[model samples]
Target: MIILSVESSCDETSVAITKDGKEVLSNIVLSQIDIHKVFGGVVPEVASRQHVEHMTQVFSEAILKANITIEEIDFVAVTQGPGLIGALLVGINAAVAFAYSHDKPIMGVNHLFGHIYASQIENEMKFPAVALLVSGGHTELLYIKDHYQIEQLGSTLDDAVGEAYDKVARSLGLPYPGGPVVDKLAHTGKDTYKLPRPYLNKEEFNFSFSGLKSAVINLVHNAEQRNEKIDVANMCASFQESVTDVLVDKTKRCAAKYNVKQIIVAGGVAANKGLREKLAEQIKDIEIIIPSIKYCTDQAAMIGIAAYYQNKIEPAKKDYFIKGDSTLDINQS
Candidate 1:
């Protein structure tokens, strides 16, 4: 099946053409990092406007690169929610228009589900798997027993890991979209700052990054007050180590508790080299799957893969209406 998917849940305007959900014929993503970098974070109105400006061009490029005409597309898939409503609407409306014109089936996919399925693009997902989804807007742990059967194992009570990373980077005078920047700096220094690992001993699977974030802020402020030269790289390395330690430990405990056959890390933060290395070193008994860097971030190919499964499990009706839902929950969807 040829699936054309659109994803504009956030700052990226993306489109992809996939064959049988596994093979991506063409995946095109136009990032707004250059635009948002000036503001130090995403501006919803700006993101929405940019999507409107770039959606058409991005879609066309994906189709052209796929070397397939609109007539060859079997279905249209799009991210419908759990993102900025305005940004989400851009993709949904475009997809709705295409499906309406082509008279083809259209599936509304949950954005988080897209993140989880991203690993499937390169590795076949095993049943009874545990997924650790870490992103700018969300931090969640999920248990998957089948294609449609998913349970929320845990989630962050305050700021998501990516949010914490950005905030910490800003405090250290790092650039916007701080996760990758921090990860790169982390490798150059040692973890000498001794940052606290929040909720490390908690029995529940929930996460709490707020305390850790505050700790970093206080450490930075204290050093500045004392006029002491701080080691920015070492601080970054220390912060990353604390976060990675908690994430890996919790995920390992969950995998053992649930007796899952495999573990998959998904979402944008899953691209962190620190987290990937930690998982590789810690989770030795079970299968571990992490999507390639390209698929780890927001993209349409993952949405297409998710829609393929959604279509098989619950086909959309002819009159089904697509809408943007910023708070759409994956477990309920």
Candidate 2:
């Protein structure tokens, strides 16, 4: 089946075409990072407007690159919730229009589910796996028995890991979208400063990054008051180490508790070199499945993959249209 998918969950306006849910024919993503960088973060209104401006161009590019006509598409899929309402609406409306005009089935997919299924592209996934989902707006650990069965193991009580990263970066005078920058800086520095690892000793799968974020901010503020030369790279390294320790330890403990043999790391933070290396170094005996960096972030290809799996359990209605749901849960269809 050929699936045409759209994802405007945040700052990206993306469109993708997939075949049989495993092969991505075309994945076009127009990012507004440059536009949002000046403000040090994404402005919801600005992001939504950009999505509206580029949705058509992105859709057209995806179709052209896929070398397929609208009639050839088997169904339409779009991220309907768990994201910025305005951004989600843009993709949802585009998808609704395509499905209605073409008389095709339409499936509304959860944005988080899109991240989870991203690992399925160009690869086979084993069931009964534990997935650590970390992104800008969400941090969750999920238990996946199959495509149709998923349970939330735990989630963040405050800021998501990606959000914390951006906040910490801002505190350190780094640019917006700080996860990658911090990760890169961390590689060259030493963990001289000892940052607290939040909830590392807790037995639960839940996460709390707010404390860590505050600790970094306070540390920076205190050093500035003392007129001490701040070691930016060292602070980055230390901060990353603390976050990585907590995440990897919690994930490992969760896998052991659930007795799952497979572990999948999904979402934007899965692209972190520090996190990936830590997981590889710490987690032994279980198979770890992580997508390439491209798939780790928000994209429509993942939405297409997720829609295929969603369709297998519950088929989409030909005449049904969906609206954007900003708070869509992972367990909800």
Candidate 3:
């Protein structure tokens, strides 16, 4: 089956074509990183504008480069919600229009499910796996009994790991999308500040990064008041150490509780070099399934894979799609 998918859930606009779920014919992503850099974070309006400008070409190039014609597409897939409203609407509307013109089946896919199903591009998926979803907007642990089943084990009570990274990096005057920069600097400096690992010993898998973020802010504020020069590298290192510690501990606990044979680390933070290394070293004996860096974040190929499974069900035909609540359930993920 030829499935064409579009993703504009956030700043990046991506389009992809997948055959039979596993083979990726073409995956094109136009990143708006440079556009949002000076602003320190994504501006919803700017993201929406870029999506509108690029969505058309992104879809066209993806299909053309895949050596396929629109007539050959069997399904049209798109991310429906739990993202910036404007950004989500861009993809939903585009998919609807395309499906209508082509008379193809249209499927609305959950953003989180796209992340989990990204693994299909690499290898066959086995059920009963744990999903560690870490991203700019969300941090969640999920139990997957099968392709259509997902139970959120626990999630953040406050800020997500990536959000914390951005806030902490801003404290150190670093760039936006701070997780990666912090991870890189972490290697050069020692964990000198001993940053707090919020909810580290909590009985449940739920996390709380807001406290950690506040801690970093307080430390930086006090240092500025005292006219003390801060070691940015050490600060980054200290912060990442705390973040990774929490993720590792919670992941291990979930694995033990569920007794799963595999763990799939999904979402943008799944591309974190530090997090990947930590999981690889700690998750012994069980297979660790992570999409390649390209598929780790937002992309349509993953969306198509999830839609393929949902295609078994009749899709709801609609010209307009609703933007989902931020707290939308991951069971659909």
Candidate 4:
């Protein structure tokens, strides 16, 4: 089946044409990274406006690149929530309009489910797997018993890991979208700053990054107050080490507790080299699945893959209606 998917849950306005969910015939992502970089982060109004401007172009590009006509599309899928309402609305409305015009089936997909299915683009996911989803807005651990069946194992109590990474990077005078920058710098230095690993002693699967982020902030503040030269590389390494340690540890514990067949890391933060390396090294007994870097960030191909499954389990009605829901829960998807 051919599916055309739209994703505008965040700063990216993406459209993808996929065949059978796994093969991405065409994926067009118009990123607002450079635009938001000037402001140090995403501005919701600006993102919404940009989405409006680019959605149709991306949609046309995806269809053209996929070498398919609009009539060939079997379904239309879109991210419906768990993101900025304004940004989400742009994609949702676009998908709804397209579906209505074409008289095609429309499926509303959860943004988080899109991230989880991203790994399926490259690797076939095994049942009874544990998923660690880390992103700019969310950090969650999920247990997947089968396709489209997910249980929330744990989540961040405060700031998400990606958010913490950005805040820490800002404190260290790093650029916006700090996760990649910090990961790059970390390879050049040793973890010598001695940062604390938050929630390490907690027996539950929950995560807490606020304490770790605060530690980095305090260290940077103290160095400035004392007029001490801060080592950016080493500081980045130290912070990355602490964050990865907690994430890996909790993920490992969950995998063992559930005795899952495989472990999958999804979301934007799953692209972190540090986290990937740590998971590969520490969790040796089970298969580790991480999507290609291109699929790690927000993309419509993942949404298309998720829609394929949603269609199988919960078919949409002819009069189906959807709206942007900022707080949409994954368990309820």
Using lDDT as the measure, name the better of candidate 3 and candidate 4.
4
CA lDDT, candidate 1, residue 225 = 100
Runs in model 4 lying further than 4 Å from the true structure: 323-326
Per-residue error (Å), model 4, residue 244: 0.5
Look at candidate 1 and give me any clashing residue pairs.
none
Report lDDT (CA) for all predictions.
0.92, 0.91, 0.86, 0.92
lDDT of 3 at 72: 92
Per-residue lDDT of candidate 2, residues 152-252 (tens digit): 98999899999999999999999988999999999999999998889844868889999989998998999999998789999999999999999998899
Pull out the clashing pairs in model 3: none
lDDT per residue for candidate 3 within 1-333, as digits (tens), equals: 888988899998999999887888999999999999989999999999999998999988998899998899887888886789899888888988888888877778888888889987887788789889999989999998887778999998889888988999998899887888998898889999998887655679998899988998999999999999889989888888889889988988898889998888889888888788888898888888888898887888888888787666545344434333422788653
Better of 3 and 4 by TM-score: 4
- Winner by lDDT between candidate 4 and candidate 2: 4
Write down the lDDT that model 1 would get.
Answer: 0.92
> Each model's TM-score, in the order given?
0.97, 0.97, 0.95, 0.98
Candidate 1 residue 148 Cα shift, in angstroms, is 1.6
Total residue pair clashes for candidate 1: 0
Off by over 4 Å in 2: 323-326
